[model samples]
Target: MSTSRHPLRGDVLGEQPEAMAAFWRLYGLLWSHGTVDQSIKEIARLRNARTTDCAYCRNVRFAGARDDGLTEDRVALIEDGYETSTLTEREKAVIRYVDTFLHDPAGLTDTQRAELLEHFTPGQLVELTAGVALFLGFSKIAVALGPPPGMPTLVVPTPDWAPGEAQP
Candidate 1:
């Protein structure tokens, strides 16, 4: 289903009306906290989209990442694992946290917390957690609504697959 053809009538704001307004107000405050760089924020979002396999987010964030000077190669790397790449230490830390939080919310160890503490201040940690959690929810909604036509698919190819088997 195309995102433009989503059953919802308006933006998240228009769709949920009062609830989204409250969310936007809260998000505005969180955005002001500046816990993570905007680039990191987008990267975290892309991570969430990838984790959720949300086509809408993958396409939107891919374009946004490129516009922000993230090369296609780097964005592609984010899918397999951002921490394994040449991103800065801090960027890798954030990606690690995002991965852990998404895949193991119930199993976040004290060691992981310490890793986060090493890279982020208390306020920044709060903001990072909030941002990651927010994107988790957003990606769910985007996938449920289905991405717009032409949005890229997040599926990776299996070794046995041939060309054209994986959707773009």
Candidate 2:
């Protein structure tokens, strides 16, 4: 609507081309793999954004959740009372993993790992972990660096890609 890209978006492309290129390559590889559902990935990403308090992540990812078919009600409940909410057991499990992954990764107990293994393969677990790491890393940068000067803090930008659409 504003026709103004987040300053961080342009800064990444302009000041650090190599880093941006690497990020896109990694993002393309994982996002298109289809080893995990787009909905699940969106939820996990939103969870990470919330945990990290990255406005940039939310600005970008909120559109993704919608495209992935998550209803407004569902997104609202993600941080409020997810355990008691209507999200599926699989989603709840992913949320649980993200909690542990963000808070105390080394403290993840055997029971937790076993529970995730019950629903997802070892490979899926790895992919999910990778996704978490990517979001966490990028979120840190976004929240820390923030937008460049003279830019408004919040922007309701469109997602770079559509849900379930694979990109190169």
Candidate 3:
């Protein structure tokens, strides 16, 4: 493990404090009050972490998602061949959606579009799409910033702050 810290680990933020604060503010809203189930989003999040190989993102868990029934077994199944795993169809769809969204949005076929529509409302679709984008961008940033001292398996509260409040 590296002993250095990323500037965006909720403190330095590359010396752009207000921008980072705004980012956290939006992130807090996305997690605390999004329409989709927190567990569903968490699954996609973990999947993104694995895809991006972001150590920090992989290590941090969301308590609300866990409470909503995202168990360790389910978490373990969000890997390379998750389609054959025991995860629900909806869960598998979200992972596929994330993978496509991350790898090639233009490649999303009609069948894939219909699969998403089968399981999610338009609003939920928007949220999930935005969520994947956010997770992907941040995960890439965290990875590009380089290793940030050893991180623990932190279970962050979904409600650690108010819906619109930035992390404290």
Candidate 4:
């Protein structure tokens, strides 16, 4: 892992601090009151990372997904659809919605909205949407910074192997 933080700290802090702070404040609100499932939150983050192609977020969320009890096969299935697998129907619905939200949020249909409503309260939906948007912003920041000079880029595991293990 690299010790270097964001390369464009000045821009991120000076030009974007207020916006970022708003996101953090929203996060605090969600944490304080939201009833969103932790697993659903992790799945949303993982999908967001995959959509953004952000290595940092992907790596971080891969570990988090595992910690949340998503098996290797289940995590792999998320890239496609995990509904046919062992995930609960609610979990499947959340992952499906996250995929659609990240890929085509502007095109979200009534059906998608209904699916979310079925599984989450209005406050939880707001919190989930806010979280997805926040991660999207963070991923852009990470990619723009371009890792660090001379640091080896870390690769996120692709779910066939245990995280942190060398594939044989």
Candidate 5:
């Protein structure tokens, strides 16, 4: 279905106003709370969106990232090769943590935690951790329910084959 035609208007917010309110309440705090760099948070957010194949998540513009001092060049490199890109070691560490968290939460090791500690305070770590978990759930919801009607995105993905197709 077109995202606009989604049953729940594509956004859980419209169907479950209370839940969205609670979600945004927490999300608002995570956006600028704690000592973890805003740039790191943006990178983590973008990385989660890309890994989940949620076009809606990917399409939302992150003005915050730019405001946090990330250059367009750095933001552009987030999709594929961020590990080897021009990002600093600290930024790369945040990406690695988010990647591992999304793919395998239990796989996070003390070594990785220690690395994060080198850069983030204990409170910042909590904030970053919560943000990662929130987006993990958020991206899944967006992928399943699709974007809300009239929501803007950079580009929406198209499937190669429809639901029914003749055998090759």
Candidate 6:
């Protein structure tokens, strides 16, 4: 079967089907089952997408997030100067978390950690951290492997995959 514009699958699946399957399984789980709200997670994910400049990542939106009220207008603030944007405090915290998580996890300060904990349980924090880690790692690989053809921003069902399949 054709890869359906999923570059990560084309490059990584042949040699690492089990691992890729496991990763996508986790992706599905992150979307399907989590303590944190899907909308919040989407905010963080979008922030990562922009910071990484992964065009494919930037163009895809999660259905769960959208259904939970993540509007395109809100998504636009995932860029620089979001701190000054009219985003809610909760949304701002999510962006901060992603920026720190992506750029310098070790530099995470006491205040930042406290702010995140204010809006998240420790378990939620774990989930958010894992999600961003997956996002950053997978998005980079997808971009580096040669991106799929470009498309306008599209809403996709949250990703899931069988052991040997391409992604959405």
By lDDT, who's the top model here?
Answer: 3
State the weakest 10-residue window (summed lDDT) of model 1: 155-164
Residue 8, model 1, lDDT: 62
- Candidate 6: Cα lDDT at 12: 57
lDDT of each: 0.67, 0.74, 0.84, 0.65, 0.72, 0.81
Sorted by lDDT, highest first, which candidate order results? 3, 6, 2, 5, 1, 4
Q: How many backbone clashes can be found in candidate 3?
A: 1
Local accuracy of candidate 2 as per-residue lDDT tens digits, 25-98: 67766765558776788788889988987776764543444666777677777885899998998899999999
Best of the candidates, TM-score: 3
TM-score of 5: 0.78
List model 1 lDDT by residue over 1-168, tens digit each: 235544565354465566755665565455443645556776787788888988777766433334556665666767675556788777777787888898887887788788788878898888888989988997898777655767554432111222333211
Evaluated against the true structure, the overall lDDT of model 5 is 0.72
Residue lDDT tens for model 3, 106-146: 99989989999999999999988888888999899888776
For 95-161, candidate 5 gives per-residue lDDT tens digits of: 8899899888899899898999898888888899998888778888887765555656442211122
Residue pairs with colliding backbones in model 5 are none
Return whichever of 3 and 5 wins on TM-score.
3
RMSD of 3: 3.2
Comparing 1 and 5 on lDDT, the stronger one:
5
Worst 10 residues of 6 by lDDT: 5-14
Query: Which candidate, 1 or 4, would have the higher TM-score against the true structure?
Result: 1
Candidate 4: how large is its RMSD?
Answer: 9.5
- C-alpha RMSD between model 1 and the true structure: 11.3
lDDT of 4 by residue, 1-168 (tens): 567754455345446665655555565445334577556776777777788887766665434345557655665666764667777777777777777777776887888779778888988888888778777787888777664344333433322322343322
Q: With candidate 4 superimposed using the best TM-score fit, by how many Å does residue 39's alpha carbon deviate from the native? A: 1.0
| Over 4 Å off, model 2 | 1-10, 62-65, 148-168
With candidate 5 superimposed using the best TM-score fit, by how many Å does residue 68's alpha carbon deviate from the native? 1.2
